[model samples]
Target: MARGMGRWRVLANVAFAAGVLALAGFGVFQVANRRWQVQPTFHVRAQFPNVVGVEPGHRVRFQGIDAGVVAKVVPPGRPGDPVELVLRIDESLRRLVREDATARIVVEGMIGARVVDLKPGEPDAPAVADGALIRSEPAADLADLMRRAGESLREFDATATEARAGLEHLAALAADVRDGKGSLGKLIRDDDVYDNLVALTRRGEKAVEKLDDDLMAVKQTWPISRYFESRAYYERDKVLYRPGSHRESRTLTAEELFEPGRAILTPVGRTRLDEVGRWSKASGRSRSEIVIAAFTEPGPEPELDEALTQEQADAVRKYLIDRHGVDSAGWFRKRKIAAVGFGAEPPRFEDETAQAPSRRVDIILFTPQA
Candidate 1:
């Protein structure tokens, strides 16, 4: 009985060991193949309103190489909110985390793996912190894409309308060109108008040539015949020209008007300047006298103060000649003794420089002895 018990016990121990070995093998294999073999990585979140081809166990990659896996999909906030995707990235790539780096769900392979490809930020930037969230810029949603498409259609419609208007205007312009309406039309379609203009220009040139010839002929005959006749007629009878020419000449002086010291005016010698001024003005120009021709013995006329004796007249002339110069030669006019005028003053003209109670002047008229 003891021997039999020992055999059984040995067999039992071997069986138990085998069972333990199997369990240990299973536990080690579980840790290696599915648990410990997978790297522990931090969760990064991405929000999506729509994730068409993404699911848990979907491959995550940087470029094309596998780097991580999609771990969970949860609401961005509440249960009904837009979903946020979480990823588990291999720890070996932890150094690659950076703030500007992004994770995108990308189409991969021929079958197209739904992937989270991490784009590394510039190396100069700071690394991403633990449990950090990554922002997702997703493909356009259906409504937004449709709205953009509608906007594009409206823009295309507006462009087409403008193009149609331009084409219509061009067609009208082309018609105008055919019909010879505008300046451009005239340029394109109306050679007759241009020809008429050219012909008119030629005619004008010929007319100008004829006019020049006529002018030359007129010029050739002008100086000797026509001009001389015109000049004689203008100079002779035109009294207005005489005074104009006299005025244009330099003023004549008193000496220049007479030869040597002899005066040109009789008034300066026989009478005062005032006496000559009275001839036309103060006293009348017409003179009358009652001459007594002796019909009987020479008798004194009533108007004469008794004809003075020659000696008496000589005596009177001598006294007068001493003070007021006498006309002893008697080369002056005899005058009626109505009124006598003496020295005169200058005539008044408009004064450019005026004064109060302005300066005075005297005027006089007189008769001269004959």
Candidate 2:
């Protein structure tokens, strides 16, 4: 009996030693992993619209490096306000985080814990002060993505069903046409109807040709010829024709319209543009186009000159619309206003042979003769 009691005592001693060693190992592991927060850290506040899986103790990473952990997740005070997170980041990151640094919540891996990913800003940007609020980019939710994918699949199924129905209906209509059951099918089968249609079409073509010849003869007559020439009415082909220009234009110097080498308009520039707006209104051609064209002298930097001309033209267009209520779109959505920039290379017009000004803006009221 005494021997058995001694054996039980030995077993208890072994069990106790094993428990002590396990506890010591656990403590060492925790210390090695820095899980007990032995290092100094600072707080940074960030706001996010949705914090679905984020919570306190979530890891924070700076450019993929583990920096710290989330200390708190504060709920929004108002309904529309974002959820704010307080991050306990290591003090070493204070120099890296900038005023423009952005934060985003991302998953570590498949089925892993959610973490805060911090992206540093430009080197020239000001550093973020400790305890400052940083902006967060919106995080995409897995549940939301899955829901959208499901909705798309349903839409695709619905569209396929509709397409199938339309094709079946079309096939039935084709069968009916082939069986000579409808008016179209009857017309296709009747020889007398086809013959009559051909004869009528030939007569119509002859009548049109004769009318065209008479019109041409009248246009060549003495008085009519003079009238046509004055009007610049000429036919080039059966489908194309040319008409004379009823175009009037006003030219303004760059010195009069803008500050030197800049697109900014001056007081004098505004006055000149105002006059242009008034002139367009008084032109009495509501259907005419209001074209604003800007030109610049050839410079060492052609790109800059082109950009300047474009900006100048756009500035004038904006002023006319804002100050004069110019109708940009006319009846039937026809564009009545246009702005173009010709940088040191002006396109040739029929009656325009004189050299273009070194730098100029032209406001033209153009109407083609009807």
Q: Per-residue lDDT tens digits of candidate 1, residues 166-242?
A: 55565566666667789887777566655554465556556555654544354335232233222112111121122
For residues 44-155, could you state the per-residue lDDT of candidate 2 as single tens digits? 8999999889988888999988888888999999999999999888888888889888899987775647999999889899988888898889887865654464344334
| TM-score, structure 1 vs. true | 0.34
**Candidate 1 off by > 4 Å:** 1-42, 48-53, 79-82, 106-114, 125-130, 150-154, 161-165, 181-370
Backbone collisions counted per model:
2, 0
Pairs that collide in candidate 2 are none
TM-score of each: 0.34, 0.41
* RMSD of candidates 1 onward, in order: 56.4, 27.7
What lDDT score belongs to each candidate, Candidate 1 first?
0.45, 0.72
